[model samples]
Target: MPLSEYEQRVLEQMERQLSSDDPKLVNTFQGRASHGLRRWVLVSLGALVGLTVLVLGAATSNPLVGVLGFVVMFVSVVFAFSPPRRGGPTGVVGADGEVRRSSPPARPPRSSGLLQRMEERWDRRRDERGR
Candidate 1:
């Protein structure tokens, strides 16, 4: 649910105080990644641990342990399956640092012998008729 106006005011007040008290902590929280390689590696490691636990749980015939292992494995696998982060945008960056997309030429290039021959013939016929 959305925060009430009073609660929002309180939260904003707290945020201001926190920022004033420790700006570095706020920066750290804001800069934390949504996704990246380090995250994938950590999740993979967790998955491995989960697999080990799953095996152990099976050996011990413990339902709770097995369920925990399965849950961890499922979450890790889903998290790890996210698309790789892009290096940068596909567009070229101009000197001004703005991304500029390169467009294809107005006329597409083609080298069909049949088309060339047909054009040549049409031109010759037009010239003959003009004469």
Candidate 2:
């Protein structure tokens, strides 16, 4: 059944509140692209090169070359999976001449798990229906 006008208004209000409270949630629902296709292509090419080097090194029985190839593969994998660094100052020197590294931004604390939140909502709805 279609929602009544009042129900629609309530849903809109809830959505507005949610968006204002958690911009991340809004972005997630909008399906924003996290990374570009170019990055993936470069990573794939690096992995391919690493694999070829590894095979060549093994075929020639050169331990040094094999080790270098393995290192390349590891580095490529790390680069691929790592999150892009945000633009910010790496560190600042205090008045005491001590270097302090910048800390990451604090995340909002989650009060309850998804399941708990769902159960609470369900219970609330049941109570409303009973009234």
Candidate 3:
């Protein structure tokens, strides 16, 4: 169901807050959000290309077209995953009102096996009992 006027107002307020909180991010997302025609073109083109490739591959009984499709998809994925340029403004706001763009923190390495966890629990229990 469509949102009521009050709900719509609340949603707009939230969007405004988000835009003010991260102008750079909001700018990037805004282009994509309203790019309905562009998105439709991309989807239709992709579907057409995919269908043509599949038909060609089937008719020729050759795997080359299939491999070409896979390669194209893989390249597209790699391009999508590539990190954004650092020259762009960061979304973070500092106390002095400057943009503080920081990369995400690195994750810690995995721990020991489950047996080690069980042993640690058992040791804690034994220490508690002794206390």
TM-score of each prediction: 0.38, 0.45, 0.35
Better of 1 and 3 by TM-score: 1
lDDT of 3 by residue, 40-103 (tens): 5555566567667767776898898976765555554454455544345655544444555556
Instruction: Give the higher-TM-score candidate: 1 or 2.
Output: 2
Q: Rank the candidates by TM-score, best first.
A: 2, 1, 3
- Candidates' C-alpha lDDT: 0.71, 0.70, 0.64
RMSD of each: 19.5, 12.3, 9.3
Deviation in Å, model 3, residue 20 alpha carbon: 4.2
Off by over 4 Å in 3: 1-36, 70-131
* Per-residue lDDT of candidate 2, residues 1-131 (tens digit): 99999998887777656654554445444443545466677788888888888989999999888888888888889989997543333343333434346465589777579998899899999999999
lDDT of 1 at 73: 92
What C-alpha lDDT, on a 0 to 100 scale, does residue 94 get in candidate 3?
Answer: 44
